[model samples]
Target: MDASFDALLDEAAGAPVDGWDFSWLDGRATEQRPSWGYQRLLGERLSAATAALDLQTGGGEVLAGAGPKNFPPTLAATEGWPPNAARATRLLHPLGAALVTHQQGTQLPFCDGAFDLVTSRHPIAVQWPEIARVLTPGGSYFAQHVGGRSNVELTAYFLGPFEVGDSREPEVESAQARAAGLEIVQCRNERLRLEFFDVGAVVWFLRKVVWAVPDFTVERYRERLRELHDHIAREGAFVSTTSRTLIEARKPAP
Candidate 1:
């Protein structure tokens, strides 16, 4: 209803949605970080491994940020989107990390036992059998995944009530990994706090993370967005919960 809210909506709507960077929302939104420090742990594992693969490496930002010393002798990253793949190549090539583009939710483009350390951050979908097939014996798969019902509050706000069930739950994933012949090493999950200070941040988030509200569009949710804007104007910020899961699994030695 206010000029500020309308301006934010227009600005965020026109903002580039390329790459995995969320720095644009820096001062406008906040999320509590997982205590395990995923990048730090991933760096440690990569430094100790001979070869490594990073799955769903959006723009290779996280992988590249892990530092040169943290990288293994052979490092490869896979991205599904074209824009992200190009960006990833630009960022990762200088670091000697090869970038491979493949369709998401499909089989990875790598040989069996191709990597000893496989990592991913917020992978859209985990093909357990394919992951196990590509990992070397005794190799490990480590990742921080979006846990069950992540950002559901935000989705419910726009799309109304929806069933999430146990999808992406750590326990269920651990069981599936074991079924795929990977031994679970560690499993941890937590619910983090999230806050959005403006409607622009919400628009940008929904646009980038399409899965949050599958068919989210400004035209479709304009009324809801306006209501949320009014609520945030009165409440200072819109708060929500985000769930995260960290899992480590190892393949059995031959």
Candidate 2:
């Protein structure tokens, strides 16, 4: 871990992510199919047309899922977390995806019009214009990001005094993309529901699934989890909701 990231991590430590994180989803963020979801957005057509550059590539799950052989041999991923970079590389090495590189999301080190496609999955540090600047004029951009106004009920329950959700509206992000000179192709805001066996289970899932949380105390979370379990067991199930957005945009065709 970079010592610089220590302050960032500290600032976010145990803090509930207004955005998205693995801690909240419990290893199930990508496990479920959207019957009508963005898998279609990341379709063979997009892959075929794109020499993709994945930004903020996490554990390399997105990289592998996108089919390394189908995309450009030079298809690359950017990651700043050394641990995440190492883990992603090791995880995708078998797929011939050693193409991953270490970099930050805010600053892409590529030239103007360097790629045909760029993808990000709910980046904690969103720098869309920087991402737009490196893409080919006719290229496209795709992302599956956490929607603003998500997880209100659960967040309110768990962190009573705190504002639990970040207001990243799809319209706002899409508008920003447009302002950056990227044309909006398609945008979808979908609601996802998660059920916790109990409150502790929910906290554990949130910590792992929604890695965006910066302020968390195991004991505090556990106590709330216990209360939640009792309440849910007596009721039926605890329902937590999240709104996710899938965005597709394009640079003007050259």
Candidate 3:
């Protein structure tokens, strides 16, 4: 409603949200990193892998962060969004990695037992059977999944109270992996702190991470955004929790 709110909303709305890079939120927001250091661990795995695949590789940023030197001889990634797919192609091709534009929840285009290592960071959906089908015998799937109810406080603020389902729970996913004939090697879940310093950060976040408020829009949630802006002005920052799960599963050797 106010000039500040309008300016913030316009800035966030107009800013580029094409890639997975969140550098735009540098000072506006902060999120605690997972203790396990997923990138470091992924680098270790990539260094040892003969063939590897990264699913839902948004912008291929994380995979690229693993360092080109650590990349396996055969490295490939899949992304569904065309903008992100193009971004990934530019970032990965020079690193000797192939990028494929593949739809989420659909069967992966790779052949059976094609890769020795599979990885993803915050994949929208995990196709367990497809993951198993693509992994070689004794190969592993290591990923950091978005846990159930992640950032519920932020979502609830905009959408009001809602059912917190078991969609991305580690236990539920592990069971699915087992049913898919993959042995759960390790699973860990952690809740991390997230802080939005201003309303613009919230706007940008909701715009980028569309799942947070499924139907979020500046016009649609203008009143709610104004209220949140006022609250942040008074409180200095709005805090929430982010849930993450690190899972490692392996196919049977036989």
Candidate 4:
């Protein structure tokens, strides 16, 4: 939540233009079923939850997937970017939802014990205590994120270490969640393959999908683009990237 993060968010939000609409990514991933390893891991528990909170509601795929909310538990969508908020509105409102833009820093605006389930897909992974503070007793938090140094080898092989930047370390994230009084309910992790047509698509995706552009400038972006092109020509038509860590933890019952 600093200027660096703001810059990354600004660049990171540039996905729709890059062939990354829900249907493109989610639709295809849905068919793979294997790519859905994240959802499959948490599906049953999430489906049964009443109130739900989706933090960092990027494209709100999880929000859309949460299904018809008849069972009631104050479902809320918390997002960051202004455009994403609008998009989430379009995606979630029809399902009877109006999302709130979450205020950054360490404070979450909701009252303590306000939700029965919390979910996020590679959200910044900050504000664990805030998440815990808002969860109702016996609540659960489900998240799928880029684990720390999680996919370094693939990244370095393709574009070098400096080009790969993300903030998801299982130890750090889970530790914070546990410190906030949540139990390690379940964890599922695997090296997965998400394909792009070529390195241009891969570069674009690293900028958007993985949020790993590492805060460069116009000139630097060009340099990185060239580097990615060179690597692709040398390696092959596609690049393989790996991300791990999908976890569900539970808040202790009061």
Candidate 5:
């Protein structure tokens, strides 16, 4: 039998959201993967690098998934959120990677030209200058960034109509990288499908990805959640779009 709305809500709300893992939502929601196979590509790059750094490495999930055997001689990751940082430390230390607790928007705590490769998956914000500063000559930065207007439909649903911003645009990011003295080697963007099988999935998602609905709360958004629940009941699922960008930049050799 299908679970009740309240039951689903309680289950999702109580589910632990530690780390970057989304296994809890496995059967409740689905999102399409990019064609570039970021984790695989990351593993390949890590294999060739002598020293590597992963910025905003949420819970070190992706880094660890890239295979510790593929890790460079020197591997390090930075995460800002305390809970995530603690979780990442536990997961990454055993893999021989050091975890640095770092807040976003601050300067990276690494020496200049310290790493041959830098990578991230869906970093909240890219510190272009810091990235350039930390990369050795001829080093590269590879990452799959969350593009602008990502999940705008889902965000707009709870907040009402809003103006879309140009933040996270690939062209804008490429320009910023160039201004930071890195040459853009590759840039690609894709819009993918996302679906929520139930309101519980939506609740868990908003709770996990707090930025989606900055002020989300069951008491605050209960009415809207109920409306969405009905809509999904009639429509089978609540559909949305997600944007992603694959970007690669290289520092000059000279």
Candidate 6:
């Protein structure tokens, strides 16, 4: 309603939401980190592997941060989103990792037993069979997944109460991986704290993470936004929980 709010909204809406980067929301929002330390674990795994594939590597940010020294001699990454694919190329090419753009949920373009390690962080959707197919016997798949009903409070605010379904449930994912012949070695789930200080941060987050509230538009949800804005203004921040799952599966060795 005020100039500050309007300016913040316009800035968030117009800002580039490319890649998986969230630098813009550094001071406007915050999220508690998972205790398992995914990036640290990934770096350790990458250090030991001879060949590896990173699925849905958003801008190769995590991989690049892990440093080239940790990477295997043969490294490849795939991104489904175009903007991320290009950004990944720019960040990973010099690090000797080839970036490939492929449609999510489709067959992966790699030979059977092509990689010794496969990793992904918050992939849009996991193709269990493909992961098993590309991994050699005894190879491992490590990932941190966005679990079911993550940040549902935020969704409930905009849209009325609705079921999120079991699509991203850990049990469902574990069963699928097992059916694909991958042995579930480790599975951990956690719900972390999330805080949004203003309506602009919420707008930017919804736009960037499109799956959060599909078809979200400020114009369509102006009234709800105003209400949430007022609530945050009065309460200081809007708090919610975000669910995440850490899974490590390995192909059985014959």
lDDT of 3 by residue, 1-254 (tens): 38989999999999999879999999999999999999999999999999999999999999999979899899999999999999999999999999999999788999999999999999999999999999999999999999988999999999889999897998999999999999999999999999999899999999999999999999999989999999999999999999999999999999
Regions of model 4 farther than 4 Å from truth: 1-36, 40-43, 69-73, 150-167, 217-219
CA shift of 146, model 2, Å: 1.2
Q: Which candidate should be chosen as best, given TM-score against the real structure?
A: 3
Per-candidate clash tally:
0, 30, 0, 3, 0, 0
Model 3 steric clash pairs: none
Clashing pairs in 4: 51-73, 148-168, 148-169
lDDT of 6 by residue, 1-254 (tens): 48877887788889999988899899999999999899999999999999999999998998898769899999999998888899999999999999988899889999999999999999989999999999999999999999988989998888889987998889999999999999999999998999999999999999998888897998898778888888999999999889899999999999
> Could you estimate the TM-score for every candidate?
0.98, 0.78, 0.99, 0.75, 0.98, 0.98
Q: Which ten residues in a row have the lowest lDDT in candidate 3?
A: 1-10
Candidate No. with top lDDT: 3
- What are the per-residue Cα lDDT tens digits for candidate 1 across 17-91? 888899999999999999999989988999999999999999888898886778888999999899999999999
Candidate 6 to truth, TM: 0.98
Instruction: Tell me the tens digit of each residue's lDDT in model 4 across 1-254.
Output: 23432343345345454211545343112211235555544455556877778788776666576465332445778887787777887787777655888766757768888889888776655677888888898998888766666435535644555643344656666777788788988666666565443333543455554544445333446555555455555765344546567788888886
Instruction: Write down the lDDT of every candidate, Cα atoms only.
Output: 0.93, 0.66, 0.95, 0.62, 0.94, 0.93
Query: Which runs of model 3 end up more than 4 angstroms from their true locations?
Result: none
Residue 106 lDDT, candidate 1, scale 0-100:
79
Q: Positional deviation of 11 in candidate 5, in angstroms?
A: 1.2
